[model samples]
Target: MALEYSDNMPHDEDDASDASSDVTELDANDFPDHFSEREGRLFHSHGSLPYPLPVDSPEQARLNNLHRILRDIVELHYLGPVAEVLCDVRGRQKRVLDLCTGTGSWPMDMARLFPGVKIYGLDIVPIATRRPERHVQFEIHDVTRRSRWNDGAMDFVHARSIDLAVTDYPKLLQEAARLLRPGGLFFSGEIGRYVDFAHGFSSDPAHQAPRAQRFFQVVNHSLQLRHLAPIADKIPSFIQLSRQFTVPTIQTFHIPIGDWHPNTVMRRIGKMYLNALKDFAESLKPMLRETGMTQHDIDNYVNGFIHDIEHVRGLVGVYHTAWARKL
Candidate 1:
């Protein structure tokens, strides 16, 4: 899928037939192994990821679905002068790192794409695959803390959808700056909490989600309460503020929230995004419970959110991807 895929027929990459987005409905009293049940939802008891979502199989499905959606939107595993940087260099070892690598799918794909490159994926929980390619290393580490990699040791660093776990973008940028060599690139992509009818992302209420603006606000509030960053819209600014990189190139992807789009490919992306939204609403359970929401009321809110967003027309999420070269 490319920028010209607006009216194109849906391909396998853009379709949900892969079943990665087919989240299994769980029984009321069921709990998976090594997972803790909180307010009728499952959660990871491992190192703090500051995530309210379940770390179970279903949650992994949502993550995988989202990965595909974003890739289809951008038409690349990454954005930037990545080709020149990752292009095969004679007699030199190139390295890549993925932070908060849920399922380790990104790095895995990158390894296959660049067989000669060494890739490392770090996450709070173990990656889905116990055994990966020889040059690819998967490890358990909380990205919110410092990484073990030495200074200027990486050729590229990738962080996607980590706002749920990281509170400070500037601090994270500093870490990326430390890890990258001169001319190494840093790439980041994140979704904003606010959805609007127009691409301007206007502050005017008329341009916002017709029936779900309050929902976005409440979600942002909950994230702030946990000292988590809900939006990475200002990451390019943070990168510039750190003075560790050249001017960043920012790319925006208008992800539809429902099957309301006229374009066939966009509508397909919308349906997939809608599925992710439902699961995300479900993932809010544990956090909402901590905020004193009763299980009954929480369930009602989740159901209502799903209904509102599904019917809302022209509701589009703004996703920002920024990439820059280290100074």
Candidate 2:
């Protein structure tokens, strides 16, 4: 979150005396962003995107790390056939919508790669960046409710890590359908809420992460209280049942949790993913408090989860990405 660029304009030597007259100097430690702090972490103060995580620099770094890992694994900004859809066949720039655009990395990347594509990032708070590149715009809105945007207004829609924020996943899909023109594309990717092991791994003494499991169990309970639950697996069914999309594709990638993977590259990926998860566990502390857990209990669970993810080489998680084209 270091200042992207100096906000104050430079003045000539003669005008140095007048610099402080009109321009207020910003303190080195000054954070202009407003947020609600909990457990020493800053969370978004408003909007319908009730994602229970910090909106500060550390959380943003974690999100960006996860984004980089996903991109490195898939080696692409998206999984579906979107390049053709993004082509300007209508004699106008193609429209792209991103839901819960955390860190706004994906849309920004798309904007840079496809200058002709219009990328709209929707979120409750604008934590992405102060300056947006051309063809990239950010919108503040509630994802739990229908958006004010018109029907069939986009050529493509993208959503990631929205399982916790959006209460009704199926309804969101229906909303995506409403906003996508005929033959438009929709894509979503989510990391599993709970940890799972790689093949031939189990909860036995040799491979179990008991504390980690308990932490996620608590998380599941917490989510239920908030009218949200991990529904990454139901994404395909939701898309199919809608009957508004065709050729729906579903894929799951195994993400290693630590540096235990035998493959050199995977080990690197695992270490990076684990580093990101450590930050993620910290961000969940405030929300976990609402589950009636004592401060000591929250600290213990979070610390344990971090330790397990860092030390348990067999620890793994699943990333599910689903995409389809509007019929």
> Model 2: clashing residue pairs?
none
Strongest candidate by TM-score: 2
In model 2, which regions exceed 4 Å deviation? Answer: 1-34, 47-49, 203-207
Residue pairs in candidate 1 whose N, alpha carbon or C atoms collide under 3 angstroms: none
> Candidate 1 regions off by >4 Å?
1-35, 47-49, 198-210
Clashes of each: 0, 0
In model 2, state the lDDT of residue 197.
Answer: 84
Q: Once model 2 is optimally superposed onto the true structure by TM-score, how far is the C-alpha of residue 33 displaced, in angstroms?
A: 11
